[model samples]
Target: MSGNSRYRILFAGTPDTAVPSLDALVGAGFTIAAVLTRPDALVGRKRVLTPSPVAARAAELGLPILRASRLTGDAGRETLGRIAALDLDAAAVVAYGALVPAAGLEMPRHGWVNLHFSLLPAYRGAAPVQHAVIDQAAQTGACVFQLEEGLDTGPVFSRLERDLQPGETSGAVLADLAVSGAELLANTMGAILTGTATAEPQRGEPSLAPKLNQADGFVDAARPAAAVAARINGTTPEPGAWALLEMASAPAEEAGERPAQQRVKLLGAVPEELPEGTADLPLGDPLPGHLHRGRTAVHLQCADGTVRLVQVQPAGKKPMSAADWARGLPEGTRFQAEATAETATEGP
Candidate 1:
């Protein structure tokens, strides 16, 4: 302890997920020198420029704020210079989007410890939480580790594991972890500041979780129903899982344009079981992404089984039950990667 006082540290992160850790540090009586976050940028559907969640939280705490941008070359150097002037005992990072070059990493006395949202040596990169859900991982958790130049290849201080539940979206799972991890992070800090914590290099082969894109949310009919459900869960409340629901037969319009596809975001779903008296369920024979109805539910065929879309939001429309959508569809409609104008020529 510095003169039996709270450890003076720097907090750096940008997203809402990172807010809890900073708040925990304050609760633990850490003297935060300054909070560093990415510069405010355009956000939301209306594209409003807004401060990062970390910056806003810092403001509420009355902590000094440092707005950093595009951490590279001269800009990186300038930011490092300002950080050095703060004379931090340690720096704690959680979900900070920018990579801290080794130059900045080496400046602190205890070095920078990152609160990564994963068990080290697995899913070791950005978007780990979402990747874990997409991959249907049975378990995942948080790791408090020292930051190194090679991705998440750092020495681990502590970890807190959490189970992945069926149909639980990454957003929900992470919300739980972000709050719990904050306490784990605060406890780990107390040990480090008092010189009791140990750092061990991560073990096992590491898997990379590259950043996800819009294409990742595309639900393919060729995948298993369980896989589709996982994709929907993984991508929900973000870029979102989507499908182009269509049919084989349709009235031809004089304009010759392919009818605009029903672009619906998958918010919730469940694997469908063969209902009583239903024929032996076809896992693969049906056209993949084909839509069907069972009295009150909407079912989509996949390579291995069927899934019921519970909640969906059509683009430009409010969310509604998938059953309601199915009620309006022709008996044998299917989903496609994209509809073609040429398909309009196909007979009913």
Candidate 2:
């Protein structure tokens, strides 16, 4: 509706990524009827109960909230009915992490809209932002689209483009998009309410971004160096990508002779071009997973090149830079992980 229409809107989301749009609506004077967020769950150091980030923010802003696992079935249907009966001009979702179903989708007078983290028709699904970084996409952006029953295939109301800076973390990219999407939403929604909003059909071939799982972080040194480096940057900060190590061969383990085995997460890395004449073949003489420099660089030989390790953390240990941890390792230490070991045993 117009900026001055004083329309009632239902907001749905559950994480930090959704906060910006919610805040923008309040700031722009939209009448928010209720915030629909996930139920509180146990989390962190002491395993204490914690509210969904969206819920916490909504409470802070004095907005009513509707917490539900998913809006389905008769019980959920009743909730949807109530939401629809609220005379909401529109319902908006951003990273809500649940399906709205047809019931809720039909409730609002203006239907539902979603603030997806990727450019529409590209990277359309859960984990789009993370996948974009991992895949090294040239660019990524946010798209505000009217929600259909299908997943993220709706016609776009508006889209904003953003460049994916080198070595940008997924969290950073998401934060950037959230604010961008909020501004776009405020403008686009204002237009739709005032009869100026336009929806454009997605033209390119459809691609999917499946939800990322814990196993997605496992990194094997045998792959090409570029792939390994990309994986490291893509999955950092959560479900962190990592490799395994044999304690006896581990540089850190050699000094203290501590545990017999360990798992180390590679949070960050720096890829280096190979020197000439290192390998007899056209490729340089980098040995997969073998450390070239133990301390300063945590340098390792990959399939075709070298990667200088930056940040790392052993299991149950705080993260530290590779240079800091390398001091304790021997001069010729190597990194070995379970995935590599399994591959070795499995044979080529």
Candidate 3:
């Protein structure tokens, strides 16, 4: 068969990050036999049912769609049967959110190809891009690999690398990768159809990047300023990094009364560096968790140094400049100190 349209294939994905690859495949002239995505989920405060981004896009493109929360038991059998009926030459997966069954793996002649955010044999698992930022990785990129049952342990077909920029959030890096990775996915698909694709075993030691939870987003000032900055940026636009702001008690209140605490999301964080000859200024170094507000900005002291809070979002409020938020703070107000033991650490 000649040309991409001659090869029938299935496209499986979910989330906004996966939409680009689906579009790229269609633009590359692939005959997308069908699209598989997760079932509609309850989203937002109202709990309205919402279709996955891929499912919604597939609907817009007028392509057949298969929705499954998971491919297991009877649902797995039915979906697999339906997929098999398409006589697919191969399948392309990008953040599909679920694992493919062993039976489904053999249905495609060229097997299933996955577009993972991180290079193979390194940072393998869900949340690769997030973990890469948190761990301060020098570089990270995308890989198109043959998918098996293991957790991102697959032979690679093609790969692309990009350097991680300082102070860049995981969300920003992932968004960039999603676009560039879409092109990589489409090229790999074309190569596979033309029988020019080569699969090679992954090299180097492996690292795990498990999914992060709400607790992972807690920003502890006890850690070094760089680590605190990394954690805050890595968790941004998702679970969201936040710190506890302690309110000062009134002067007439009981001597031993505890201060009230408010949760505030730390949207933009970066290590602060004092200008030359400013060391002798009255601001001298503040204790960890203490706030130092200047005319133009607000800085929070950490273990080694201080981090500038560029933007902050108070509970139930929109994000605002740290300087604006600090203007109304009580004289003794500061961030609540968190125990180092409660902080989240990267897995080996």
Candidate 4:
């Protein structure tokens, strides 16, 4: 705790990513008047009611917790009143999920400061990190900005940049950003208290990163191998990338069964180079969607090249290595490419 103990701030966020910022603020010695997170919701296969990650962490910190899904309805009025009573100097938000209404925004003297995961003016919606990974960006960063009614369109106080590692998934990048960005948020708060904080208008061509859906996770083999690999990595661990596996025919034990069309999730994938001296061979140039099962790995042919499947999860089964999964498949098994309305365009 520093001399900044007198500053009372409301912490608003709801995910594991937000937990770090909350912890940082408390560790930095500011008074956390209360924590605002979404209400508990059913989670996992057991349908157990689960608090948001921030709520759970706040409980461990013995901090007051206020759960609300939104700040605009009748229930929101009650939440707003509760917030107003706190007499907060400012509110810090990180992946809060719900938008703050105009009335609620006015409750804090310094307004709300948000820690957004992307370099604003670009990837400015719900899925910034995921969209950046899917777009195969060379670099991406986080920004601490003033939260306004406009969608992440406020002036930024501070930012930190990190280069995208080769083959890194969105989940991995975000986890790292959470920790570094937490420090940034804490420092920004310190600057705010000392009257040294400065925010400038964002400068860049704005781009949108709308929330990704199940359809966005569909892996189309008609795309180039690099694109397919990017999509798999981008959506890993959430609405996971998947494709329909079309078996050549039923096994001898189930001879009468219709050719199996199983939906399988691709857990790990990467573009691969063909074996030495085989780059120009027909075996190395498989048609789109063709499955080439090698001795230890399973490869899929894409529009321009081959992508190796490192891991896969069959419906109703736990994830397994692609080699292990491919060993049991019948010959001529291949991924079925679904026709999509639009293929993913290049760049962010």
Best by TM-score: 3
Q: For model 2, what is the error of residue 151's alpha carbon versus the real structure, in angstroms, after optimal superposition?
A: 0.8
Give per-residue CA lDDT, model 4, range 1-348, as digits (tens).
478789999999998999999999999999999999999999989999999999999999999999999998899999999999999999999999999988988889899999999998889999999999889888899999999999999999999999986567788899999999999999998897778999999998999999999999999887877888889889986768999888886473377765668899998687896555433236544556777777777778777678888799999999999989988987677887653314422222
Tell me the lDDT of model 1 at 253.
35
Kindly report which residue stretches of model 2 are placed more than 4 angstroms away from their true locations once superposed. 249-260, 274-284, 294-296, 337-348
RMSD of candidates 1 onward, in order: 5.0, 4.7, 3.1, 3.5
Better of 2 and 3 by lDDT: 3
Q: What is the C-alpha local distance difference test score of each model?
A: 0.83, 0.77, 0.87, 0.87
Residue 294 C-alpha lDDT in model 2: 37
Instruction: Residues 1-348, candidate 3: write the lDDT tens digits.
Output: 337888898999999999999999999999999999999999988999999999999999999999987778898789889999999999999999889989999999999999999987888988999899989889999999999999999899999999987678888899999999999999999998788999999999999989899999998887888888888889987779999998988843476777888999998688777434423236655556888777778888777777888799999999999989999998778887675433423222
Winner of 1 and 3 under TM-score: 3
**Tens digit of per-residue lDDT, candidate 2, span 217-246:** 877676666667767777876568787665
Could you estimate the TM-score for every candidate? 0.89, 0.87, 0.93, 0.92
Q: After superposition, how far is residue 248 of candidate 1 from its true place, in Å?
A: 6.2
Per-residue CA lDDT of model 1 for 266-325, tens digit only, reads 887777764654432457345566676667777777666678788878779888988786
What clash pairs does model 2 have?
1-193, 244-336, 244-337, 279-285
Worst 10 residues of 2 by lDDT: 339-348
Q: Which 10-residue window of candidate 3 scores lowest in summed lDDT?
A: 339-348
Q: Candidate 1: where are CA atoms >4 Å away? A: 1-5, 247-249, 253-260, 277-285, 337-348
Cα deviation at 142, candidate 1, in Å, is 0.8
